[model samples]
Target: MNDPDGGTAAMALGAAESGALDRDAADPGHRDRFLIPPARGGRYSDSAYLAGNSLGLQPVATRNRLLEDLGEWARLGVEGHHDALRPWLPYHALLTEPAARLVGALPRETVVMNSLTVNLHLLMVSFYRPRGTRTRILIEDTAFPSDSYAVRSQAVFHGLDPDSTVLRARSADEVRDVLAARGENIALVLLGGVNYLTGELLDISAITAAGHAAGAVVGWDLAHAAGNVPLRLHDWEVDFAAWCSYKYLNAGPGAVAGAFVHERHLGGAGPPRLEGWWSTEEQTRFEMAPVSRPPASADAWQVSNPPILAMSPVLTSLRLFDDIGMDVLRARGMRLSGYLYELLEGIGADVLTPADPPRRGSQVSIRVGTGAAALCSRLSGEFGVVADAREPDVLRMAPTALYSTHHDCWRAAAALAALLPEVS
Candidate 1:
């Protein structure tokens, strides 16, 4: 049967077996930028790394770029803040333009600062306001754990009970209906741009319009969406959004995260927020004046000085994105992810991620009976394919567009087919 996205299990299986798909989609040179881990026995030569959703492969350029900053630090010490190449004082600016393009925000509206959750809380301190009856926060049932915790804690910090105040939606339509019905009572609508576990992309524009019509502020956790999918946060009029750089952005682990605030909230209309030295205007920041003159942009949300070491890799990855461009990368991702879905379907595994190209990104999640965890273990241990398992019986395989090729997809699917009988 042909899937709605024009994917056919039979065709995909034939292609995998005949190696036609691999030959057609393989780009030998693209894989060179990433440093793939050495697999045991050198099986498959390069390990079928399908875990960019969890943690992306390191960019080969990241080491040399980081070394430049480290060398400057060693040579100049405190002087590195101002004197060294890519000086620490304005280091964060390097991320501004390209980071803005990655998420469809203007340079001023986007800032690379603390980790995802930290940026979320900082944005919340300014955007999430509950008064009288409108004291609730709306979120999808499956939002990332950190987003839920941060939203719940924000409610409690304002002395509101989470049980009564945090609303959960199971689908995009439900989100709109809830906003229409309870928007008056809901102070904020925070949902993931893409559901992490299921890889179901949400309709940010539709939901944002619904929330705004109901007088509720809307924000998105773009943790799984940022580099995996194209975003138009500014055009969508999303009140705020944040995402981590460690996944599709490939900035290594625990790298600096990014935040976006609508232009409307940047200047005089921006709400009161937490203050920090980095949030102040750069020119007067050194003056150490007691007055906090925050810049008229998302940088006002920054709480501390940028961590140069952590920020270096982020810049490296963003520059790569700039070179490849989101439109090209996203088109490649849709094809790769769809091919993986077809292969998984042919193997008789239930795919959880949406088959609709617009409703999913690079990750394809599967339900491989009761032995899902074992299947994942064997896919790595026995077959040299690295996939992740979620809970009772779900396995996630992400074929990142940057380094993963059609051959990687075939190898992973072939391994799944080979291992399923043994594990089951």
Candidate 2:
């Protein structure tokens, strides 16, 4: 249900056009850099694009790659698998370097594979070995439904009761308390690098240390954090992690996802992996022997072959990230988003995400009061500002760096201010 008062009816566009703050104007030429929907009908349509943190706009390069791949298919026939310029034989491997660079890890430590939820389960299968007293798994209470479901199912698969094995933390104090109280019994810690709904970036390094102190393996779900924030997964000593490329990475819908296993956790020197042909030894990969020799690295975790169509989009997207660069992109994101935060703060909207610039990533979540969902609906329906709403009170807005701009942020802030009077 929307707010009974409908606060944004007149104020939506009014607040957006109300003399945007000076900082909202990024440098002249670059100002229109990622203007995707290009200004249609006079005003601004990039404002309709604040939802990249949810699903990114399709890059023009992505479309071109798709066409190129389709052409290869039409001309090369069945032999295309080996005859094509980008051979399907080692397609997944091609993504290793760029993907590893994106998340800050050694190439062998990362592999573009399965969906986020599936990879989480596979990583758990290898890492979540429960011993006598150390059988619990620590997870966030507000984790995405997919993560929560995978954790619980893994617990059941281990012959442990989910009720007893699932330990949860809500607030910072609660998190500290759970780790202290049950640290000795935790077998694995599965946390999101950045939460899906709240957009809270977790301290993976600190949490990993705490979990390890208790003799537990620590893994993170970076579905929302992977491309949106700077991550040093290898440096942080993470045992394992997984993320979808569709969100911040802006791969197409349901695009191939990626996972990481610290170099220390690969092959015989590593934890027990659930294997498949893709992770088979390259030397004897086509020998079709009765016995299987696992790949030397994290590739050992794969249980099946990869889908090439799904990976092409990911390849194009990462190239763009490399071209634009994550460091430069992230810095602008913080500054531009910080301005958005002030604009919302100025209107008395309660910011739920951390205010500290370093702690937060690309997203800024807000609690716009009792009628938050309704106001959000109106923002999309009436104003064409494509932000998303979270349950009872929160609205999540992220100005992605690769495609989003300063003017987009200003427009969104102005839209919110316009709706203030109607709700109040």
Candidate maximizing TM-score: 1
- Clash pairs, candidate 1, are none
**Cα distance off (Å), candidate 2, residue 210:** 1.6
Candidate 2, residues 1-424, lDDT tens digits: the string is 1333334433543555534434444332133434365433225454457777778777777777877778888889777788987878788888999999999999999999999888888888888999999999888998888888888898899898998899888955566678888888988889888877767788888888877877889999998888888889999999999999988888978888999999887656567777778778777889998677887677888888888778889999888777777788778788767877876776666688888887788898887656777987777666667787777778889888776656666666666766755665
RMSD of 2: 3.3
lDDT of 2: 0.78
Candidate 2: worst-modelled 10 consecutive residues by lDDT: 26-35
* Stretches > 4 Å off in candidate 1: 1-15, 20-29, 422-424
TM-score of 2: 0.91
| Residue-level lDDT for 47 in candidate 2 | 47
Question: Which ranges of candidate 2 are over 4 A from the true structure?
Answer: 1-25, 28-35, 38-47, 371-373
